[model samples]
Every structure is written in C-alpha cells, then in structure tokens.
Target: MNIILKNIKHISVNEGITINKLEQIIGASKGVLSRAIAKNTDIQTKWLVNIVKNYPQYSCEWLIKNEGEMIKPTGEIFLTKENIEETAINYKDLAESRKETIDSMKKEIMYLEEKIENLKKQNELL
Candidate 1:
C-alpha cells in the first residue's frame, strides 16, 4: 500500500476507528481515499490540510512525506501535578492577557472607524 493509505490505516487503528470513521473525521467521502489508494495517485492538498486540521495530533510531515512518527512528539499530554498546576496558571494568565489585548484592539478599531467616518463627512462637505 502507498504511504498515504498506510498513514490513514495507522491513524484509524490508533484512534480506534474504522476507515469509514476516518473518512468522517477527515471530512471526506467514504470511497475517495480508497480510490486514490487503488490508483496510487497523490492525495489532494486540500484533503490533506483538512485531515491535518481535524487531527492536529498527527504529524503532517509523517502523513505526507513519511518523514516522522505518526503522532507528533508534542502531542503527548503530561498529567503530573506540577504540570497541571503550571498549565492552569499559564492558561489563566494567557486568558487575561488575551482579554486585555482584545479590548484594546476593539477600542483602536472603533477609533479608526470613527476617524474614517469623520473624513467621509469632511469630503462630502468639501
């Protein structure tokens, strides 16, 4: 089998799902991948991208080029108490920072939009 089909099979087995379920996860038709495998042609880029997006735990390099492991190294989760505490703190800090940034951006956008509206009115007056 081609690397593409092999990767798909690997993912299905790892995820404990069938080929049909894999198709569902990748948002593709049931027979599309099978046909591609039978023809031994390259799978389309869009399909590959969709699959990667849905299953970010899988290494894209491995999926397309067979260059790395199926599951990304960073995809592993550490559930130690220290790790959990650190993650919780980091998440809270990130959320607060993001909220502040988003609020500032909204204000800046509103200011720019008002300035644009004023410029439009001035042009109309001219």
Candidate 2:
C-alpha cells in the first residue's frame, strides 16, 4: 500500500469511519478511495489536501511523511518555527501549481469558445 493511503486508512479507522464515509466527507466520489486502497494505488493530491482540510486533528506531516504522531494532542497547535517555514515553502509551491492548472484551463476554454464561434458561422452559412 502507498504510505499515504496506509496513513489515511489509519485515520479512518481511528476516527471510527468507513472508507465510504471518509470519501463523502472529503467530497470524493464513491469508491475513489476504496479502489485506490484496494489496489494500493496512489490518489490525487487534491483528495489529500481535502482530507487535511477536513480532518484537522490529524497531522499533515504524519499523513504525508509519517514523521509525527497520527493524532495531534488536544488544543495543541501543530505549528512550530520549522513547520511554519516548511508550510510557507509548501504554500508557495501549491500556489504555483494551482496557477499552472488555471492557466491551462483558461487556454482550453478559449479554444472551445473559438470552436463554438466557428461552428456558429458555419451554421449561419448553412
């Protein structure tokens, strides 16, 4: 099993939730997680991000790197100086990745719009 999937399973089990329930909570399609878990395949980064967002009690470091305790202590903030620096770097990287995706999507939309315009012109001729 991928380490991330294994950790996710651990989180689900600890929280007394099933994989299907976890999927719903994370806004993933049904079997998205189950199939990945069953096949020991990697899941998308967005799902991982959603899981982190929804389950704040679990440590992102532990989910990604298995470096810390699975469940954070109650009322304890997970951030430290090192974590802050690392998170800043990660945030910048995520921002750049998202920007690239948005740019690609914009290009695709423009192409589709041009195609639609051409089709309309041809229809008018017909």
Candidate 3:
C-alpha cells in the first residue's frame, strides 16, 4: 500500500471513523477514498488539503513526509518559519475572498429589498 494511504487508514482507525465516514467528513465523493485505498492508488492533493483542514490535530508534515509525530501535541500545528509566513498569506487571501463574498451578498439583499418594496407599492395601487 502507498505510504500516504496507509497513514490515512491509520488516521481513520485512530479517529474511530470508517472510511465512508471519513469521505463524508472530507466532502469527498463516495468511493473516492475507499477505492483509492483499496487499489493503493494516489489521491488528489485537494483531498489531502481537505483532510488537513478537517483534522487540524494531525500533522500535515507527518502526513506528507512522515517525518514528525502523527498527532500534534497541545493540538497546535508545528510550523517552520516559512510555513508560518505561507499560512499568513493564505489567511490574508481567504479574508479578502470572504469580504468580497459578503459585499456581493449585501448587494443582492439590497436589490431584493428594493424589489419587494416595489411589489408592495404596485399592490397598493391595485
């Protein structure tokens, strides 16, 4: 079996979750993980990203390189200086994206409110 898949299986067992449940938690399609694990094939990087995002207690370095402890002590990620800088940039980008989404939603809400007000005025005239 591929080392990464092996580690993932170990994680599933450690967390007391079945493969199907892990797929659901990671938002992966049914059979995505199970099939790959069964076949010992590679999975996409996005699935690895989702796993890290969903299970923050696990060490990504360990998952990728198998160099560190599988689970992080104190539930905090052990990060190098470069990793810390990269994470800061990622957070900045994420914040900007969320702000744009919020602005767009606000505009949509305002437009809908105006439409409702217009409908109410038209009803009053009828």
Worst 10 residues of 3 by lDDT: 86-95
Q: lDDT tens digits, residues 9-113, model 3?
A: 988877656777678767899999999999989999999998887666788888887879999886386566755665565456456656776899999999999
Model 3 steric clash pairs: none
Please provide TM-scores, in order, for all candidate models, with all chains considered together: 0.53, 0.58, 0.59
Question: Clash pairs of candidate 1?
Answer: none
Give residue 80's error in model 1 in angstroms.
Answer: 21
lDDT of 2 by residue, 25-93 (tens): 678999999999999988999999988866666888899999889888877656567556754654564
TM-score of 2: 0.58
Positional deviation of 67 in candidate 1, in angstroms?
1.2
* Model 2 misplaced stretches (Cα beyond 4 Å): 77-126
The best candidate in terms of lDDT: 2
Compare the candidates by TM-score and give the number of the best one: 3
Once fitted onto the true fold, the runs of candidate 3 whose alpha carbons sit more than 4 angstroms away are 75-126
Residues 9-124, candidate 1: write the lDDT tens digits: 78766665556655655678887776776677777777888776656678888887799777778746335675566446545645665677689999999999999999999999
lDDT agreement of model 1 with the native? 0.72
- Please identify which of the two predictions, 2 or 3, would achieve the higher lDDT against the true structure: 2
